[model samples]
Every structure is written in C-alpha cells, then in structure tokens.
Target: MLNKLMHSPSHKSILRLLRNSMASTTPMAHLLHDTARQHWRLLMLYLLFVLLLSFSEACLFATIYQTMRLLLGAPSFTEIAGFGFTQGQRLFLLLFLISALQMVASMSRAIAGILSGRFAASCQRSILPEIHRYILSLSYGCVSSFKIGDLSHQATLAPLTINTEIDERIRLLTEGLLALIYSLVLFVISPWLLLMAGFLGFCIILTQSWLRPRIRLAALAVEQQRRNISGTITADLQVLRLIHTNACQEDSNRRFANEVEVFDQKLKKLSNLRSLLEPIAELLPVLAAVLLGTVSWILSDQQNGLLIPGLATFVLALQRLNIRLAKLALSLNALTENQPRVEILNQLLTPSGKIFRRQGGTPFSGLKEAIVFKNVSFRYSSRQEETLTSISFTIPRHGMVALVGPSGSGKSTLSDLLIGLLSPTFGAILVDGKDLQTLDLSSWQNSLGVVSQDVLLIHDTIAANIAFGSPVVPSPEAIRHAATAANADGFINRLPQGYDTMIGEHGHRLSGGQRQRISLARAMLRNPEVLVLDEATSALDSHSESAVHAALDSFSHGRTVLAIAHRLSSIRHADTILVIDAGKILERGTHDELIAARGAYADLWERQVHGLSRPHLHKQL
Candidate 1:
C-alpha cells in the first residue's frame, strides 16, 4: 500500500508542484538555490526533521481519536482492532503513545529551528562578500549612476530581504506539507467534512488573492519612500556646512519633515494591509467549525456513537489544517511584499544587468617609452555630443606633459581615459605601442599615481591613509618619505598624534591644502612610474602651491608626468603644453613657445595673469 501511494500520479504531481514553487529565475533566487544545493546535506536533514514532525502530529491525532472513542464507550479495544487487552491496558497504551508523540514533535521542531537558523547565517555570510566584490568590480560609470542611499539599500538591505524570503519560502513549504497531511487524515475520517473544509480553504485563498495586489502596491510605495528619505538625509548631512552658511535650516527642516510624514503614511497603509491577513486567517477555523457541525447534524441518520467520535476527529484535523493554511497565507503575503527588494538585488548581482569593467589577460609591468592616444574620442552614454573628440597626445618616459583647458573642455575626461577609469568610445590608447585595452588594467593602474582636485581621504591615521591602496604596506620610514616629498610632513608632524592622528570623516578636520597634500602623499607612496595630476594644486594657497611646486620639481626627475591645470603658472616649465577647447586641442607646444605664438594658450595666460594683477577689480566685476 505504501509503495502504491508513493508511485501514484497525485503524489508525483505534489512533488513536482513543491519543486516548481521553490525554483525561481531571479538572480537572488538563483544564488539561494545554488547555496542550498551546496548544503544539500543540511537541507535534507531539515526536511527529515519536518517529516518526523508531521509523523508525530499524525500519531497524536490518531491517539486523540482513540481517546475520544474510549470516553464515549463506543467500542472495546478488542472489538475495534481485535486486540486481546483490557480497557485499562488500552487506555494506558493510548496515553503513553500520545506522550511519546508530543515528545518527538517537540524535539523535531527544535532541531528544525536550529538547522534553519544556521542555514540562514551561512547564506548571509556567503552572500555579503560576493555582493561587495561585485560592486567593486562594476564599471565606474555604472556605480556612479546609483545614489549613495540607493546603493546602500541594495548592498545592505536587499540581501537581508532575500535571506528572509528564503526562510519564509521554506516555512511556506513546510506549512503546505503539514496542511496536506491534515487534509488527508480528515478525508479518511469523513469525506463530507473534508469537502467543506476544502471549500472554506478555497474561500480563504480567494480572499488572499484579492488582497495580494493591494498589499504589494503599498509595499512598493513604502520602499520607494524609504529610499527617498534615506537619500534626503544623506544628502543633507553631507552638505550640512553649505546649509548652515546659506542659513537654510528652516527650509531643510520643513523638507525633511514632509518626507517623513509621507513615509509614515505609506508605511501605515502597508501595515494595515498586511494586518488584514492575520485576522482573516484567525476567523477561518470558526467558520470551519460551524460548517462541520451543520454537516454532522444533516448526517444524523448515521450511528450516533460512530459519528460522534468521527466528527470530533474530523474537527481536530480541520482545525489543524486551517492553522497551517493561515500560516501559509501569511508567508505568501510577506514574500509578495518583499518582491521588489528581491528584484533590485537581482539587478545588482546579475552580470547582465550591470556594467562590469572589462578585464584583459596580458600583464603590464611598467611604461617603456611613452603613453600615446591615437585619435581617441569619448562620449558619455547619456550625452549626444562627445566630451573628448579625436584628441591625441603622448607622454614620453620621464617627460612632463601638461594640459590646459577651460571648464567642460575635456581635460578631466582625458585624464580619466589615461587612468583606465573610463574607456574611449572610439580610437585607441597605446602604452609602449601596445593597445591599452589588451593589457591587464590592474597591472597598468598599479604603476600609475593619480591626484585630482577632489581629494578622497578615509577616517584613519595619516600613515594609514597614505598607504591605503598600496599593494604592499609601506614601512613608517617610507610613509614619511612620501609625505615629505608631497610637502605634507611639516603639517602632519605639527599634529599632536603625528602619523597616528585620526582624521574625521572625509578628512573634514583638515584644511583644503592639507587634504590635497595628504592625497598627493598617498599617490606618491605607490612609487608609480607615471603620475597624473588633475588640478592637484587648484585648492592650495599661494604658499602651499609654491611648496608643492618645489616638491614636484624635485620629485619629477625619473617619472612620466601628465598635468591638467587651469593655473598656467604651474605648467610654465612643462616640456609640452596642449591647449584644449571644445573637445579639440587648439595648440600644442612648450608654454614659452605657445606664448611666443600668441594663440589660445597665450590668450589664456594673458587673462589669468591680468586677473591676478587686479584681483579686487575682477572680484568686483
């Protein structure tokens, strides 16, 4: 009989349904599925415990039916099952079986709970690092498109949501199995009661289906509002100084309050919708009981003694089924609400959904001769006009090349291309006559140092920040040497903690010139073969600029340098200067030679020199 049931079409169908229900095509679902397959032993053990729990429940229900029969004096044990036992013996055996079933049920439940918690912890441990690594691997443009708050939500919260979804899915499966077992037992006791119970269950499912879309919509609204609120707060905090200087505190407060109010409204609506499922679920068993009693009365023609025991057992099974059904409904609702978060995580983790930087196989050691750009052009993906157009330049080994251009004239874009942060949309960049795209980017970047106007400093000691990204941690001596070369040693030594002083977030505690010098120190510590400076001294005062220029004069001896600057004085001694305007290089020569030509470079030099001569006049205008 057991074999026949196992091989039955209905049984096969049930197995297929459960399998299909668990399988999903979403990226997060795929990750969890792969994780589960890797830990199949634990998963199988968990299922075994669940099955044991169901068996204990079944045994408990059977014992209840027997106890009911004994209380009503329906039949002796010998008459019912041909057992040669006295009434007292039969009663003792039934009570002992009940106790044993409860013990088994408790043990199985506890074991299953422990296994599930461990599995969740393991999944989280494996998933977080993978997400972080993938985020780091994404192309610069792709990552920049996300707001800080939105990206934070994706990285920290989305994985947690998916993990919870996995747990809820398991619970849904368990409840489904338990519900099926109870239904089967109800069918055996009384088919008429089982049919009524099935009808009531169908009603509950229909009600949940009606509520599902509304709850999901409300959940989406709440999630969107949450992202908005987080983004607003982060943006506000980051620019707190600006707000204070402008005296916009009242406006900022009002804006934040409005956002919070909207979030509260949406969150309240979502809560109200989710709360509907529980109360509806709780009301189901009462309806089932009423219907079961009515059906029993209608079938009163049957033997009262047999009917009473059967009716009692049928009600017990139906009540258990309803509880499982309600739990299943709640799990489904929770999964529905988290569906949007799952989709966001899917987009983030899925390769096809994100832009990943291309990696090459060939390793690069160091520049041999020159870095050349051959008719390179670049347009942002969202723009119609190219940012850099057909630009070409070369920085020979140990040579100093400078780029001077107005704002939005492609100077920084060119530097980004040289640094490998961005790839040219057309043409090619060659390092030692080899295509830049064909060389390993990591190897190429490791040999280059970059310092831009906007310095990035973490909240760490001076030495730690200087040595942050070096392939090898530098010794204290090396760090000091780099700082001295950047002209930052004096200021750092003046600090009470010296190299061990903790900078505040983004190094906000430091002056602009101090921050720039630390950034330069970080770049110099790499001992790079090439140094690319993007207006590195633009924020420095005259004294600091002179000090940095003095350091650069000494430091540029054996290194190839690419300098992009608006202050022409800094690049007056560069070996070659390229004047760029409207995505094109209008002039290329030494600064002195360009001045002699009296062209665009000469005109810019004249304007800057004139502006400095009459600073008050320029400020007034």
Candidate 2:
C-alpha cells in the first residue's frame, strides 16, 4: 500500500501542492519512485512483519482487559455460561497467559523493528551508489558549475534523510495499525466511546494537515541555509593561508559567525513550531480520555447499566487510542517536513538527459598517422568571445609537438580539445583522417597519459600513487622502473618506508619538485602512446628540471609528445613548434628554423634567454 502511494498518480498532485506552498521547483516523485522500486521486495516483507506484530499487539491488549476484569471481581463470559474456573484460579491462569502473550508480542515486535531497520538501510545503500554514479556521469562543465561543498553535502545527506524518512514512516504505520485494532475492539464494547475517539482523531488530522505545509517550508529553508553554511566554510578554509597572511582572521571569524547565527535562527524557528504543535498533540489525547471516562461512568450508572469490566476495557483502549493518534500526527508532520529534503535529494541524484557526458562510439584503437585539427573553434557557454578560433595543427606519430604562446593565448584550451575533455563548437579533430568524435573518448583517454600543472595525489603509499591508474597494483619491479624513468626512485629510496610510506593528503609531505616527479612516474606507469605535459616540469627547480628533461629525451623517441610550456628554453629541441597568439597559430616550424625566421617564436626566445641570464648579470653588479 505504501509502495502504491509512492508511485500513485495522486502523489503528483501532492507534489504540485507542495511546490505551490514551499516554492520548490524541482520535481522529485520520479526519483522516490525509482528508489522504492529498487527495494520493493524488502519493503513488502517489512510490512508483512509489521502486520503480524500489530495483530499480536491487539491480542496483548485483549489479555490485559480480561485480566483486569478477573482482578475487579467481575464475572467472566465463561462463568456466565456455567463452565468457568473460580476467580482465584481464573486470575492465576490469566496472569500466566498474559505473561506468555506479552513475551511473544515483544519478541515479534523486535523482529519487525529489525526488518524495518534493514529495509531503511538497504534504501540508503541503493541511493548512495546511484547518486555517485550519476555524479560521475554528469558532464565536466555541469559538475564544475556547482560548489564542491554544496554537491558533497547533498550527496551525503540526501540518502541519510531518505533512510530516516522510511524508518519513521514504517514505525508510524505499524503503530497506527495497532491503534486501529484497539479502537475497533472499543467500538464493539461501546460505540459512544469510539465516536468520541473518532472526533479527537479527526481534530488531530486537521491540525496536522494545516501545519504540514509550514513544516515543509521551514525544513526547506533549513536545508538551504545548511548548504550555504557548508559552502561558506569550505570557501574560507580553502583560502586560510591568504586570510592569515593578510591578518584578516577577525573578518573571517565575523563572517562565519554571521552565517552560523542565521542558520541557528532558522533552526530556532523550526524548533518553536514543533514545540507549539507537540503540546497541542499531547493535550488533545488527555482531553479525549477524560471525556470518554466520564461518559463511561455515567453510562454505568444508567438503567442500561454498562458493566464495570466493559467500562474498564473501554477506558484502557481509549487511552491507547489517544497515544496512537498523537504518534500518528507527529509521524505525519515528520514526513511532511522531510518532503523538501526528498525533493532536493531527488534533484541531485536523478540523471538528467541533457547533463550527462556523451557515451557510445567506436573504440579508438591507437594513433595511426597523425592527430589533425582542422579549423576548430570553441567558446565556453559562460563566455561570449571564442577561446579558440580557426585553429589548425597536426601532431604526427613519434615526434614532439610544442605549443608556445603568451598567457591566455588558447594553448590550454587547444590541449583540452585535443584530450577530448571539451568538444569543439565548430570544425573537427581527426585521428588518421577519421573524426575524433567517431572514436570512443574513454579508449582515447586510456591511450593518452597526462601530467598537468596541478597534479592530484591520493593519500596513499608511493607505489599505490604511482600505479593508481591500474585496477590491480603493478609489480614492484614495474613500479620501480617507472619511478626510475621519472627520476623519482632516488627520493622514494630515501624516504623512511620507501614505496610503502604514506603520502599525506595531496602529497603534502613531499616537496613541489618531488610531487611533480611522482606525478611523472604515475603517468609513465601507463606507458602511453601519447604523453601530454602541461607545465609538468614548471614546478621543479633547475636541477630537477634538467633531470626530467633527460628522462624525457630517453622516453620521447617512440611516443607522440605534446608539451605546453611557459619556460621557452624547455622546448628548444622540439621537432615542431607552434607559436599561438590570441587563438591563432602565428608561426610553426622546427625550433631552430623558427628562431631563424625571427617571428613570434624568436621574440619569445630572446625574452626567455634575457630572463634566464638576469641572475648572472646581477652577480656581476
């Protein structure tokens, strides 16, 4: 039944109502429906357990009523039929049976609770992985548009919220079923008492219905503020060095304090609302019980003469009924409050057709002749001006191709295009006369190794980081060979645990040069057909750079190498150099040939030589 409600067409109307009340625009019913489908079998079993527990719970109440009748000296129905034991013996037997029934009900409820918890846990397990997979599937551009803190909070919190919602709702359902059974038994005794309970329950339901939208709105506000707080803290932490250097600690503290204060204020408002509702919920149950008890006493004294045992049973059942109604209201309120969270979670977890990275194309075997870019142009969606314009280049197999240009001259954009991270807005990138788009990007990436300006290292051992790309840990000899090729083996050998040593987060324990060398080793481990170095050696000091250059010389002969360099001296020995200026290739030639041409490349060379010689000139002074 719950599963049916989750997917029923009526839920869409409820969502529309919620949207109108809370002003949430994201559609979420589909996401929740998908989640339910994933665990429907477990859910059905959980409901089955609860149903059995509810019946046992009702039987326990019945036993209690009969035991009270025997204690109160009332005649049992069996005695009226002339077949009953004496009251003393009857009470003793009732006590034993009540104890046995109570124990059975308790154990059954416990088992039901366990199943309910497992079902909730299974929902979380399912949602978490699906969210992760969807995030991975999103386009690079789409993923980058959201703050990391916001994304991380939603991903982690959403599934947890769903789990809680499921558990609380299931518990409410079972309890309500038990209450219904008790109420029915009361109705059989005295319709008057049941009628009063019906009125009180109706009042509770009306109260919850009126407050449901408010709770949802408050919850939505709370979540939005939480995301804001997370984003603020994350941004502040990332620039802690800048804050301390500028002596802006007090300002940062003030900002963080303000954010937290706002968050707290929202929390207090939500708390106040719940506090107000809880008292009303508690008081209604008491008033209903008092009214029922008074009516029962009056009825007992009348000529119709309600029996003492029946009155006692009605009063007990009414009290239980009151508790259930109170619980039902609270549970319903809780479900309403979490509705906004579910919507947000659904938005985050749901796979959007337009936002996903493209998939399904023929596998790129390997570079056959050359990678050809024909009049390619690209502009980021966020920008009006083109980042690359009518750019043309060819990188042949087994040679070095260097792109040199002024900063922001589209060198990096071209590299991003070449690596299939960004598709061109116009024109095509071809491999061996075939369009790059026709080949599988994943396979293309697999064959290409990249060492960038900002290298990422996981918090792991040297060997693990070096062989991170592989599904299995590579042989130690293979790891060592890669490390030797990147000139990282020397440093690894000197560390306390060598290859077994834990590198701190982002390789924080290693020096910049050491980190770069380790990154190079990781790329070399792939033994890629094409190697891309985007300022890979820029972080290294002169001696380390020379060592890396020597390693490159030994390794570059068999693979196509693409280098984006700021230090002009590094690419002087390139097989071909393309000097890009303002999204256009102004010059292309062998390094010596370009220098003779005295074009953009020659001008850049002069400036770099003068820059390199400045220290010597200063020493002379």
Candidate 3:
C-alpha cells in the first residue's frame, strides 16, 4: 500500500532535495508516505520484534490488574503474611520485574537502532554521491537557478534534518505502537472504562486536525528562512572585502543582522505555539476521567455499583492510554513538517531527465585531436534571454585560440558548453570530430584542464591542490614538478612544510596570486589535451600576472588552448582571436586584422586602452 501510494502520479515527484516539503505536497502525509516507502524492510523487522515484545508487555500489564484484584479479595493470613513480601512488596517485585523487562527491551532496541542507523547512513552515503552527480550533471541552465551556498546547505545542512527525522520516526514508532496496543487492551478489559477515553479521543482528534495546517505552515516558514539564510551569508562573505573597501560594512552587517533576527523570531514563535498546545493536550485525559467519575458516583452506590474502584482503576488506565494516543497523533505532524525536506532528498536521489553522457566521441585518449563546436546556442533556465546564440567554432589541434568579448558576451557560456557543464539549447559540440553528446561525459571531462576566475582549494596540503584535477592523482614528486611548472614552486618551498603545507578553507591563508598559481598547477597535473583559461590574469598585479603568464607559456605548449582574455594585450599573440558581440562571433582573425576592421573588437580594445589612459573615455564603451 505504501509503495503504491509513493509511486502514484499524483504524488509530487521527489526532487533531488530543495526544501522541507517537496516543491509540491502537504508535509505530514508526505513524510509518513515517504517513510513507509524508504524503510519498509526496517519497519517490517521492527514490527515483528515489537509484536513479540507486546505479548510480554501485555502479560506485565495484565498481571498488575490481577494482583490488585487478589489484594481486594481479602484472602486469609497466609496470603497476606509479610514473611517474603507484603501486599505492597509483592506488587513492587512485579513492578521491578517489569522495569527489568523494559531494560532488556531497551538493550535490544539499541542494537536494532544501531543496525538501522548504519543502514540509513549507508543508503545516504550511496545516495549522496548520486545527488552530487545529479547536480553536476544538470544542464548549466538548470544549475544557474541555484546558488552554490544554498545547494551546499541543502546537500549538507538540510539532510541532517532528515537524519534526525529518521531516528525520531523509529523512536516515535515504538512509543506509538506500544501505547496503541496497551490502550486497546485496556478498552477490551473494560468497555465502560473506555467511555471516558472517547471524550479525550474526540478532543485529541479535533486539536490534531487544526494544528496540522498550522504546523505545516510553520515548517514551511522555517524551511524558507533556512534556504534564504545560506544565500544571504554566502553573498555577504563573498563580498566581505568589497564591503570594507566601499565602506558599506555597516549596511551589510545590518542586513545580515536583520536576516538572523527574523529567523530567530520565527523559530521562537513556532516553539511557543507548540508549548502552548501542550497543556490542552494534557488536560484531555484528566477532563474525561473527571466526567466519568462524576457520572459513576450519581449513577450507582459504591458498595454494589457497576462502576466500582476496580473499574475506576481500569478507566484511569484507559485515560492514560488515550492521552498517549493523543501524543502520538501530535507527533505525526512532525513527519508532515519534514515531508518537503524528504521529498527534496528523494528528488535528489531520483533519476533525472538530464543525463551527462557524451555523444559520438572518442575519449580524449592522449590528446590526439581538437575540441569542436558545431552550431551551439544556450540560455539559462531562470533567465529569459539566451546567453549564446547559434555559433560554431573549433579549437585547432594543439593550438592556442583566444575568445575576446565585452562582459556577458558569451565567453564563459561557450566554455561551459564545451565542458558539457551546459547543453546547447539547439546544437552540438564534438571532440575529435565525434559528437561530445555521445561520449562518456565524466570520463571525457576528466581529461580537460580548466582554470577560471574562481580559485577553490580545500583545507589540505599544497601537494593536494596541485594534483586535484587528474583522475589518478600524481605522486609527491609529480605534484612538486607540476607546481614548479606553474611558478608556484617559489612560495610553496618557502612555507614551513614546503609542498605538504595546508591551505585553509578557500585558500584564505594564501595571496590571490598564490591561490591562482596553485589552481593552475592542479590543471597542469591533469595533463589534459584541452586547456581553458578564463580570465586567469584579470585580478593579478603586473608582477604576478607576468609570472602566471610565463607559467601558462610552459603549460600551453603541445595543447589546445581556449583563452577567455579580459585584458586584450594578453591574447594579442594567440594563434586566432574570435571577437564576440551579442552572443555571435563578429570578427575572426589575428589581433591586427580585428584592429584593422575597427569593429566591436577595435571598439573594446580602443576603450580599454584609451579609457584607462584618461578617465573621460571610460564611459564611452
């Protein structure tokens, strides 16, 4: 039944995770449904074990009731004699045995829980990489709609919520099942006792229904805040330096503060609401018991009554059970609240329409041929406009080709398309005269060497950074050699640990130039056929720029180079310069040829040189 419901077309497709509930679904029903689907084997095993234990639990409950009855019967002195145990002592011993049984139950539960935990974690481990691969596999158009920070939080942060929920579901399931069984037994023992419980049940059911919508709304609020929080922090941290440089630190701080404050307030409100509801929940059983006692008193005499003390004790048991059932009903909302998050995780785990396989291509296989683009066009999914129009170009075999353009003129878009990071809205790219769409994308891309404006380095050794791109990481000696080629050897050698030194998160300890060099070294270690350098020197000082450029000269030899040059001077010596304007190649030739034509290329070049030379021409471009 659970599997059938989960697979139904009406159920929202699980997203590769996005938020609390999936993009579509009510949380409680979704979580319960999803949990049933996700952990069927565990649930079945747990249920079987619980059923065995319930028999034991029922024996314990039934024994207490019978023992009290024996005491009330007022037997002879032999039964009442306190030699081994008094009346209280006998009952206490039974209670102690029940407590011992619970302890045994707890131990077994721990072992079972550990097994379940390992299973879920293993499933998650297998699923996480697939999630990552899905994100990596998405069309750049689809990916651009997401922020790396938010995705990071979702992939790492939000999934932690699911982990907690998994544990809670187990905890609640046991408690709920035991309570349910115990309550049903109480009702069976004395139906008159259940009369009071019905009132409590009515109250519990009414409250649970009302709170479902509200709890879901609160969960939705919490999820929204969490998603936005990561993005806000990401943006602030990225431009931290700019904040100080422009003296906008105060304003940025205020924005961050506001975001956090709002987040805290929402959390507090949700907490307060849950707390306020607790008393009402507790009073349900008490009110039902009081009503039954009042009616029982008026309806019959105590000495010869249908509702006697024994019956009242039974009613009290049922009342407790009713309250427990009420608690279980309330907890079911948490599952709902967690539904969106689970859907997102499920969606992430779900197979996608976007497949990254390469088409009609030979593997880069020792750099035998050039990278080719037949006719290519691309637009971001979120953005209304196309970033690259129908354009065709090829990087010659082992030759340097430069792409020159004004900002947002499709240079980055082309590089992304060539890398299989984005698919063409309308055309194809080829590697070695074979359609790239037909080849093994990850395997093919594994052979590419790309260096971009963003320099990402992990918290690891300099050696690790230098050998990051290659499928088979180089040895220590190999890492040093690659570093030497990138002109990163000097600074690396100066560090206390030499090649073994760690670079903190974002390579924060290193200078910008140092970080860029390390990134370049990593690419060199890969020893790829296709080399792409996108604005490699755009942020460097002249001295650093020259050093990196010198390193590039060594690296580019015997490789096909695609350079997206920000400073026109850098690409002047390139084998071919493609001047791009409005997502199309406006001019193609040597730098001097483009200069002679005096088209967009000449306009941009003239503006760069003339604008920097004097302030007046800067606005002209």
Q: Write the per-residue lDDT of candidate 3 for residues 1-621, one digit (tens) a residue.
A: 222323533232221121232333533234334544465566556555655565556655565554555456533232556456566766666567667766666665566666667646744654456447656655555666668777776677433555556545655666676777666665765566565566567777788788777776777687778778888888888777788889998898898888888889888867766664667667776776677667656765545333353465566566556656755765676675775566555554443444433344545464567666777888776678888888887777888889987788899888888777777888888777777776777777887898988888888888877877679957888888888877889889899999888888788889998898888888888988788899887667788788878878877888888899879988888888987766888788888988898666677787678863323422322
TM-score for every candidate vs. truth?
0.91, 0.89, 0.81
Write down the lDDT of every candidate, Cα atoms only.
0.83, 0.77, 0.69
Checking candidate 2 for backbone clashes, the offending pairs are none
Over 4 Å off in model 3, which ranges? 1-49, 74-134, 157-176, 297-309, 343-362, 366-370, 540-551, 595-621
- Give per-residue CA lDDT, model 2, range 1-621, as digits (tens): 121323434234322332233222333444444555556666667677677767766776777777776666666555676765888777787788778877877787787778767866776777777667767778776687779888888878766676666556666766778788988888887887788878887887788878878887888898889989999888887777689899999998999899899999998888877776677777887877777777777766543333666777777777777777777777777877787677777566445533666687888888879988899999988899998889888889887899988778888888888888888999999998988888887888888888988888999999999998853468999999999999999999999999999998788799988988989988888888988989989888888889998997777779998999988788888888988877888889998899798666676666678643334322221
Superposed by TM-score, candidate 3 places the C-alpha of residue 2 at a distance from the truth, in angstroms, of 18
Candidate 1: where are CA atoms >4 Å away? 1-25, 76-85, 610-621
Pairs clashing in candidate 1?
none
Q: Could you give the candidate ranking by lDDT, starting with the highest?
A: 1, 2, 3
State the lDDT at 233 in candidate 3. 84
